[model samples]
Target: MEPMRRTVWGMLAALFLATAVTVTGCSVTTEDPSYIPPAPLPPLEQLEKAPLADPKNFSSGGDVLSFITADRTISCSLTSARGEHVNLPYEQNGYSDAANNKLPIVPVAHCGLVTYQPPQPGDVKDDCAGTHLGYLGGVALLAPDTARYGECRSGVTPMEAAYGPGGTKAGPLTQLTVLADGQNLERNGLRCSAYNGGVACGNVSAGVGFFISPERYELVPAPAISSASPQAEGPKTP
Candidate 1:
């Protein structure tokens, strides 16, 4: 295996040494052997700007979420629920149909990445880094794919690497973006997806902040609610 350099980072999304590999969901369209690997991306600037204290504080840079590339814009406030994430991989909270509520049931169902989330132990649970990656910030690093496509979803297939605009690959946490939206957020111009030739994964994908694994946080039972009211008399109303 060879290592990538710095200059090769930014140019990746535009080059041509790309190849069309089949994945789970999205099928391959083209095959470009001319795909050339680009330079490496730079490190995320931790302190270049301060974290906006207010929740309303966002980059005036337009409707953008975290961890996406500079080209497109990621929506705001990524759903903490993985299932809702755009690029798939996140876990979706099962929705149910109402009976006679008359409140026209809001047609619902996790369409894309609104399916699954990283687990903790016996089951999958989103808890990035096992410790609360700082309620928001943490040392940026690429997440790697631990499983395959079909392994995650049954009918839903995993979309293989889409070698296009960005010359990246699809493996693990090769790219970084908001845990909420499946945007191609870039860091230092380095994106693992670009290496997969602009590959956008479906089904199973492990990349930077790909999940809220227990490896980062410890799972415990929910705190029980104590009753404040006094106990009623036994068999009174009967």
Candidate 2:
């Protein structure tokens, strides 16, 4: 009887030990309380396409005038004076609903260049490089002549290239004035400003700025197409 009792006790101990190990294994495999997944980044596929603007959108002086914003976030499309379709990509933010108390849609136009300041203080020249379009002295201008556009150290997304490390910030421009001679204009509820060298227009609320050089890019007040006169009745004979 004593041997039988000893054997039974040994078996009970083994079962208890196995049960404890099983519970311990489950505790170790439980999910972590403090683990958090990182936020996903934006996929900038638009950067892969060829750049849209060349020398301030209106480099060639023409009868029809139109301007294109370099901002990547705002969609810009209009028929050129030559009847060519022009479109630029843009990003929109915020909400329009008043009940939600959300902010209105603020559109920030993304330029196509990376602007860098000089390493030393008081350097007259800035190392503006990254893309064809660059910001200099509070103005965004063409930089391929002054600096190589694709030589920047950063990756070439419109946002990363324009405002990445060592890049310069855009100028503070408020109010929009119409560039047409003596006539002010508004488009899509935004104002515009016209100057001798270029027409500058920006919406502070939307965080957008558009600059067209030589004032010829103005699209409004375009020349009307004349009606075709009726063909002579005698021309239809075979």
Tens digit per residue, CA lDDT, model 1, 69-93: 2222211122112222222222222
Error of 1 at 137 (Å): 21
List residue ranges in candidate 1 displaced over 4 A.
1-64, 68-77, 80-217, 220-222, 232-238
All candidates: CA RMSD in angstroms?
22.3, 20.2
Task: Judging by TM-score against the true structure, name the best candidate.
Answer: 1
lDDT of model number 1 = 0.25
Tell me the tens digit of each residue's lDDT in model 2 across 70-165: 322111122111111111222121222244343332222212223322122222243445352332322222111111112223334333333446
